[model samples]
Target: MAATGSRMGVVGGSIAGCAAAVAGIRAGAEVTVYERSDGELRGRGLGIVIPPPLHRRLVGTGYLDAAMPTAPVATRVWLTRVPGERSAREFARQPSAVTPCNWGLLWQSLRSAASGARHHRGLPVLSVGHDGDGGALVRTAGGEESYDIVVGADGHGSLTRRVLAPDLRASPAGYAVWRGTLPVDASAEHLGALQLLRTSWVTIGFPGGHGIFYLIPRGGDAGPDERLLAYAIYATPPEDAPDGAGHVRWLADEHFPQEWADIVARGEHAAMTCHPVVDLHAPVAADPPFLLAGDAAGVTRPHTASGAVKALQDALCLEEALRTSPTPAGALRRYARERTPEGARLVELGRRLGRAQVELTPDWAAMDQGSVDAWCRATLAGTSSYLYADTD
Candidate 1:
């Protein structure tokens, strides 16, 4: 642990920020968190996945618990549409273990874990800079504060990153993911018609893109009323396709299976959020007093299913560095050395997958189980292996 006198500032009080505050406090540093938004963040409902191994590691670290609401996923099925078929034909089924989580609920848990740390909301961070004595200065909407260290958990558009690495920015990867979620009925009439079990995460592939669907807890439980169907469709829509859910609904009509189409059409457009997929990797993750973590350091495509895990891992790395290194500068250097390559690797893997899966897709109709297995192995190579490489 650092000296009790050591102080740290964490900007962006979301998932990464909250985790960082926990790390700082546990390292014996006085920590303060500044969140830019005023509204309750719990309302931003979304779905996230944690592979079983990483989930176990986080639980061991007390960052997560089995009691947290999660929908267990046992298999991932890859399917393709066939002519006159109401549902896509399954090409491959890969045995897997994952826990699908509600984004809001996960954030609430992390926020609770960091409850002891001072958190200031509705205060936007304007700028950050280095102090001459190897410390940092944070300028917020209210005023400027000094700290021994400043962490950038502010996400893709980070002010702290501007001071650390001015040239790095999140670049669009030439595609977008249209996502939607809606309540699931107990009768299971809607989802049951699709012939997919609740334990399955289904992936349907077409000419220009793919879609994935699974269940997430609405109130952190497995009860029927607590679950919602969450889906994400990845594709490069026509230049003239309507924005947001309209584009997603149009794609559903054109490419999705009949049953899948019905599920999407039943959803209200207001519940969907569509945005371009972007990626970033700042060549260096830290510069003296200013250190970057989470989306500010690097961003891999959602296909990797590692965003939340990566962010939490960043906090753990920061904690380890502070706990082990002899000096603050040395610790920052070590953290950067360890995370930079991992960040670059994820970015490269995302590009490779984006190219093979979206840009230059294979003929789904022609692929057999063998070919599907080979293609999937090639595309997803190294992903599972890298899940908890540093921590484990």
Candidate 2:
């Protein structure tokens, strides 16, 4: 192997780090992973979606296990609440198919694939930079290690990215999202409505923002048949907004349909959290020894649903780069050239979605099928996305 003697060090051993380690191992490089958390990372359960083609590619590339559970839906149903109605008005049904998977399950698969790499648990990376000779260095409490290449998956605040683009920063989009998930068994009362989730994901739009609902698999041995109901509500918080969960219910009661409101506001969630919507893109993906992956390279709004997809693709790209390139520097350059433009594209698309769905929202009630299609075409502005079907 061309990379037989290369040494790769990965910082932040979450999904991105683990995937990077897997890429290095597959490329014949000796790898090490640093994880800040000592405990199992499978407990924080979140939901993420990816295109079916990407999912198949990951499984084929051995980044994911073929048996990992997933809940796939074919259509995206956009809904708007009618005044004094128990249900929402369907705005648009796009042929947006996706394979939604359990975040923990996806991470576990990648981590397993990366087990060949030495893993350091409970150790945080304090800093990352290049040595005088262009070898990347990772600094920790134990000491510093020099590697042929360093992969940064340290998330939105990455030390590795700082080495290349220090001036870049994440700018807020002036809204937030309430992320929550509930076991399917617990949502007995909403079973009728949930039937729609089996084949479609729904978007309930209100005056301020919108809520997207879908079903993703639960962790453990739960098969595709057993799933978790997931929802992400994006809206601006009021001055007197309640806590995360409270705020979700507050907005639902006022804006969502009676049935939809009860589904999100009354369900017992297995996990819930709030995240401020922000977008960031690094000027470059690699500066020789230091390479950034996942959020370390860019962070788009959740509206894109490409966060996990991008990380997995980054790993695949790294594997190909190292396998084909003549030298480590060549590999880094190749990976950066392929991914940098993609990061910028995703950031731009995220901002467009955020602006149309939240910031400069239109009167959803007045929008019919033709109007929705026109609005969507303008929002996309010629950018192709997996989330929307061709309306023309």
Candidate 3:
């Protein structure tokens, strides 16, 4: 590993930040993660699909088990469309190799890997500056610290992003997402273990949008009879600009269709969360060895569920570049070169997928099914070439 320096600071202690800290520590760096919140993050999501490359990296790093102990392996996908009062079309059992894991479990694994690294809660970064010598200076509520490199894994509304790309702004994709977790027993059809483990059930609406519901098992020791967690994301029109509360109500009242009305109605029963779907024009690469990763760089529509995978990939690629490059700046440049194109590609694919769902015309049912089939086929075939070096 290149000796850039031992002292490093990572802003944000979420999944991306934890992953970056683990990578830095493995590379012989002393890392400290600053989280704005005051407590340990108990990540609460059903599951996230991990692509082959990322899965391999996590397993190799001992962040993941050879076989998932909680969530089942997702080998197939099912897509359906609701037209009128009936099911328009359904595509089932499409072969796929993607593995989905409970988000909370994955976060725990990464947090464990980053055990030695210092994690400071309730320390929100106020500002960041880069010195003429290329070192990063971060000012947080706790005080000030200088680091050889500063990583921004904060999230979509990253303060780091605002400082770097002051002019860049997030424009709504004319839609918002409503997300929540429901009990497994909420729906009789959703009760079985096989149904709850590692499977994604998606339903496209009449307009150019869709709803996805999936399940992931909870505790590692929990039996098949244990309650499975259910999560859903529905794309709906924004109600009042980017106000989170307003969007949540809009999704609950207006956007959801009759079939899913019950789930939407249960929104009040559970914690309903909403956020506007936004993506940058392109991935922004900064100088001074600082760069944006994950949602901070760019976001893909949840229709593809590729955001988490891309973030993990970014961390892996950055780790590999730092390990092989001659200098820190060179490593950062290489990481950008490798990831930017893929990020652009995935964003484009997500847009296309969203449009295919929301903008169907005649033979809409068949068209939707065909689009779903093609997407599953392409993703499963591993046709999307990896732009980064094959370090593994």
Q: What TM-score, computed on C-alpha atoms, does each candidate reach?
A: 0.93, 0.97, 0.81
Model 3: per-residue Cα lDDT over 1-392, one tens digit each: 66356467888887888888887777777799988978767655556756566677688876555554444344444444444553224444443445556676777778888887899888898887785567788898667888877888888888777766878776656666666665555654523323534354344343445555555555446563344444445455544465455544444344444444555454333345666676663455445457677777778777666787777777777778778877767777887788878777777766655555543312434554456555544443443422111111
Candidate 1's residue-wise lDDT over 1-392, tens digit each?
A: 44255788999988889888877777778889999999768767588887777667766877765567878777777777785666767787776667888888788777877887889999988888877777998888788999988999998888888887888768899899888877666324665533464768888888898888888786643462367788888999668763556777777777777777777776543257887888899899877787888887888887777777778888889889988877777778888999888888888878877887788888887877688767767776646434222211
lDDT of 2 at 98: 91
On lDDT, who's better, 1 or 3? 1
Clashing pairs in 3: 208-358
Give each prediction's root-mean-square deviation over alpha carbons.
3.0, 1.4, 4.9
**lDDT, residue 63, model 3:** 55
- Backbone clash tally for model 2? 0
| Shift in Å, residue 232, candidate 2 | 0.3
Candidate 3 ranges beyond 4 A from true positions = 44-46, 65-70, 73-93, 189-200, 219-233, 238-270, 281-283, 359-392
Ranking by TM-score: 2, 1, 3
True-vs-predicted CA distance for residue 17, candidate 1, Å: 0.7
Q: Where does candidate 2 stray beyond 4 Å?
A: 240-243
Which one wins on TM-score?
A: 2
